[model samples]
Target: MSTQTTQTTQPMRTTQTWRLDQRIRVTGGEVAARVLGEGPPVVLVHGTPAWSYLWRDVAPLLARRHTVYVWDLLGFGDSRTDPGAAPSIARQARTLAELVAHWDLDAPALVGHDIGGGTVIRAHLVEHVPASHIALVDAAVLGPWNTPFTEHQQQHADVYRTMPPDIFGDLVAARFRTATHRALTPESAAAYLAPWAGSEGQRRWLDQVAAVSFEDTREAVARLGEISVPTLVLWGEQDQWIPLSTGERLAAAIPGARTATVPDAGHFVAEDNPADTAAALLRFLA
Candidate 1:
């Protein structure tokens, strides 16, 4: 495993500034990560088509009371983009476990969104990674998690893989728009889009989409009852991709799991309502 550090500034659209200044080599590839604040460790994992930038608003809030670590999953953000690297949920879970060991974190609280939800779950349950607490935000835990857009891209990978860069970027932006109840600021949109621009970015984006499979979640869902750590199932009341019902089911499956809902938010609850999301997390983590 190799490590690198680079100081780069992201365009400040909001008060939060996301800088992926640290890179750590993991099983799949080097993952870009940022560490901030000081206290108990809290790792924020982002979902599909998004990198650590997704936590720009929420990480700082959580960092105020906890040592927060945010990292881009392999093949996303500034991480190594080897087309051969498989960013499958199962592989991502293992990569996360590897990160936990590399950081020497003992049972850090985990917050995950979208496919990231699935990653944390699998890492804890299947990979036997320990965590003091787990929070699932609009997670893709239940099976049949694919949306029409993802299905289309999965079925027509070749077409999307070779689509014009401009068109592909627009498509990604449109997907991001749908993920939130409110529109993303131009700067926020650009930050999210930066990782998926150009030919290589387009192919890497499609590769992750194509790698999506229910089998990964199916394995974890079947073993949900085995989750011993305190769990929080949080959802966006307006989530269109994964309904609130899935979140409810997930909460029910985990023993003593608490539930929280962010109104007027879509799948990306952090982006939609970071305040409520952070508050719910703070309460649970405390």
Candidate 2:
């Protein structure tokens, strides 16, 4: 089985590793998470094809001011998987609520990217989530939004059902760019793909990708009007996956919400524009 573990960085700097050292066992799986520091909780949820690791930089920065929680959704990161099954984002959202209750977080603020944004919204529908504010990073809220490459994305997700380990890694490395679509160092790129090693690992990505139904997601996106908390909309100006128009449409649908465009960042705004992402968040939360 192919397991992509971290490459040791030179142990000689003031910078510290955000060691992988936490877990939360929710229904359907035991999620791996990274938690550190302390204050009123801020939950950070990652997008598809990525795990808790994606929040490495953003989580720590937020942690300095609040108890930040970032975790892998079921079937992603080190979380368990069930082949041929793609758990709906609704289920993922429920699991998220359960996790929050387990942690005893009251009135926690939420920040989510991609589908994570949708999950946060849906969680609110379930009632009394202790949510103070909700933030979206290039959220896919304007639905019926199957971009030009949507079918192509589906085909690649389908291939995971049978691709060899090395081939799967190579394929993911090439296609992952489609998500972030930025210049990633070889090591940095590999670290993101490492969690999905081997057949079982490869299946996880496939299941989640296939689950991204445009019809269902559109219906959910339309429900944004139900959100009753303070909302912040942050989008990457260079994002190629979800259009800027979609972001604008989302800001309009959600009452009292506003949008900020990250000048240099793309879909992976947190990593590409960490400081700006943090600064905006700090202000929003404050």
Candidate 3:
């Protein structure tokens, strides 16, 4: 897994492409992540039911001036997940600690989305992982997540446990272009869903989501300030995933964290507005 992976490029061309090249086996499970560009390490951790593809645009853009690394958590993308392994925030943080250690990353900056934010926060809290900086988009951390899931969402999650693979895959793929991120082009939509299609990895994602306990997530949210790193908070003003008020509270809670509301964007901030998202990130990471 040490070999470099040449990633895909199209309308938004990178100087080059890198495949899902690196592999790190941690605690009896293998974690797969892709490394691209050349400079200091920046790890991008994707949120629920998504892989590194979530950062396709931001990865290449930042790679223009810095090293970019995107990884599939053990239960998502091409990464391996043990069926019996715990999928809680604490467990995922341990897995993340394994990832940073295996790569020998010293003080690597991290960008985490959705559930990934909670993962990184817990890693900082319990593992004391060094941080150059951290950026959280939408409602990644668990606080205020008690807002009700739509009836459609509840039905869908229930259907997922037993849905046919092809149809279920289509549903997963469709999430990239839902009413959430209206600015996504067809190509961009297809690219994000590509990795989750027809893979056992997708099933593991469903498993993890089904196992989530709202109460436990709330408990984890209470421990967030254990994260001492400088933090940047970006919220989509139009985001339906979580309210903007939550983002305000999140920023105020974390020392030195700042919040920027991207107008007209949703939870998938980088896709709907790549330039704004990247610019905001570059400024914070600077």
Candidate 4:
């Protein structure tokens, strides 16, 4: 693999400032995405409570050499979902399959983070989406992936769904804070918080949380050995949500898969340490 590294001196742009205006109709709804750069194609997927903005810093770096495609999953970010639509892992995977087809990409490199990782894996294995390379960054591919917050939300969905917008925003912000090792700047925090600011956003957020299930991930785990593409399992060394050991095991399970860890980052590695995260991806994709 290539060991090249990229350095940037430009001021870091906040996720709030990142805009994805392109919309594509998928299975259930329209997904917001943006394509950048040239060369070979790459698709980046983000996890729960996060939109493509999660890749605001990392995508630009990768776009320097690769055509980067970033999208917000159905029901998240600027994406539109049908009323009462649940953005489950399985459903998202199907959408991903359709997206790959829509993009008409031929064996493009795929990168996913958190639940996005689950979506990518399921799309490749279950949906039979082909990729030249696959990278999972702090992915939730193992069983018992749900947190106490998710468990409680799943059990009492109605309660959270009706939570006042201010309270719900506070709750979401608190949860998001825990995903990173370092403090997020006010601008960065606002960018993440923007999607879940209103009643509709709150309902969509709860719907996604309620849709979280271990079954989808368990199915992917059972088929890990069946993966044919080059795989890279990347994790945040300080991930409090899913420990690094899980990533190590995931890498070990996939035949010939490699592993890399980003130090000083938690579950949200991209936001906490985008430089190293992007570098790791560049090195692998090279």
Candidate 5:
């Protein structure tokens, strides 16, 4: 397969959002990432089952005033990873730290959603990367996050990987749909589905699903108060995956951390309410 894609570059804020058209070498695999605009640095990390594409709507807005970098975590998106490699959260955090150091970023501001939130938190508290500021949108910061389905997938990943292609696609589509309050448009659904449509893709997708663990968050939660950098805890008020209550508890744990609630949004706040999400981030960043 070709390493690059045929996508025409467009200006920020156009209907054609920026794409992750480049690959950066990382520890276990190459990560798909993109950089747009220029100024103070800001890195956007996406959570599991989603890629840097999740930031398409938000990155451009931030890029208007700051250099923005968005990347797919290992084992997701165009970032190819060895199926034999463990897809644990620590591995994801290590990859995030590697990318930040690879870019020679100096205390860049970080914005992360879902498991991406845990990755950045681990990068900051455990990996010792200095982030000027952090914004966690419905982050999985607290422990005991695995659902029954996820636990079963992890325990029987081999069996799950053998699912029929059509069945696998339907299952993922259904789960992705639940993350948003608004129904996913065909185009949006296709964008999220593109990375995990085929047999091999389905196997890797299961690997990621099975990789979700509480250990990473358990470690980060213990040190939440040590984060002295300015922080913002943004959440979708109607989040079903990680509740708004979790966001509130996280905000309370971090000293001087401010909270912003995005009304009418679900776990996928960027997809559901990018305007309010962007506005909250911009306010906190300022």
Candidate 6:
């Protein structure tokens, strides 16, 4: 594994060991990305409302054995973006595809969570991004992904955008807490909530919420069999966002794909069970 002498930084409100940080240009703006280790490439992609911080624990450990690259999706984390733009799954997937080419990661393994899982799949199916392997953890690729809350936000986007900072902060914090089987520590909660804590952040939060759409996912789900790379589907047994049954269906849909469950975990399996998640990934990568 590689090491940098620079002190750890808190760009997204957490201790990150990743270095070689740079802004890679994409469609609308640049996306923040970092690379670690020096072996076969492994890309960690996160979904909405989260940045590369989602894989803080898993990245370094994986880096010990392989090159690990993590990045924040456009409009989230330290990545520059347009606050007025609505979220588009196709756009995020295109960004991921472009990054893979820009990084020159030939046949890199992709591990994605939440909408990230969908992003990688869309990149493979629609954008034809070459991937050696894919692992979906509590992914939103299967269907019926948009929740009532997300639907309401899309419906009342104007009102949600004007919500008070404190009110929006509290609402997001509450939702993130319930995302995991275990309670998030105050520090961790604050770190995850940091991005959307201020006035400007509140507006971005509304934009992020309004951007949520399942239309692209619906299209990708229908073509799951088209993916030829080896794939693994990992899900939190107790995930409230995307259920275990969805994981099972996903595994079955993909050719020769296998499924596993992280016990006592919710949608945020890495946060709840990093060790098990890492172990599962190591086995698949091997």
TM-score per prediction, in order, is 0.93, 0.86, 0.81, 0.93, 0.92, 0.92
Local distance difference test scores for all models: 0.85, 0.72, 0.69, 0.87, 0.83, 0.81
Report clash pairs, candidate 2. Answer: none
* Top lDDT prediction, candidate number: 4
Best model per TM-score: 1
Better of 4 and 5 by lDDT: 4
- Model 5 collision count: 0
Tens-place lDDT per residue, model 5, 191-213, is: 88878888977977887887778
Supply candidate 1's per-residue lDDT for 96.
89
lDDT by residue (192-278, candidate 1, tens digit) is 787777887787888889888989989889999888889899999999889889889889999999999998788888888889888
Residue by residue across 74-193, what tens digits does model 4's lDDT show? 988878777666789998998888888877887889899999999999999998999999999999888688888888999988898878889988899999899899998888888888
TM-score for candidate 3, please give it: 0.81
- lDDT (tens digit, per residue) of candidate 3 on 23-82: 666663567677788887888887765566667777888888778878777766666666
Ranking by lDDT: 4, 1, 5, 6, 2, 3
Q: List the pairs of residues colliding in candidate 6.
A: 87-211
Q: What is the C-alpha RMSD of each candidate to the true structure, in Å?
A: 2.4, 5.4, 4.5, 6.2, 3.9, 3.8
Superior by lDDT: candidate 2 or candidate 3: 2
Measured on C-alpha atoms, candidate 2 has an lDDT of: 0.72
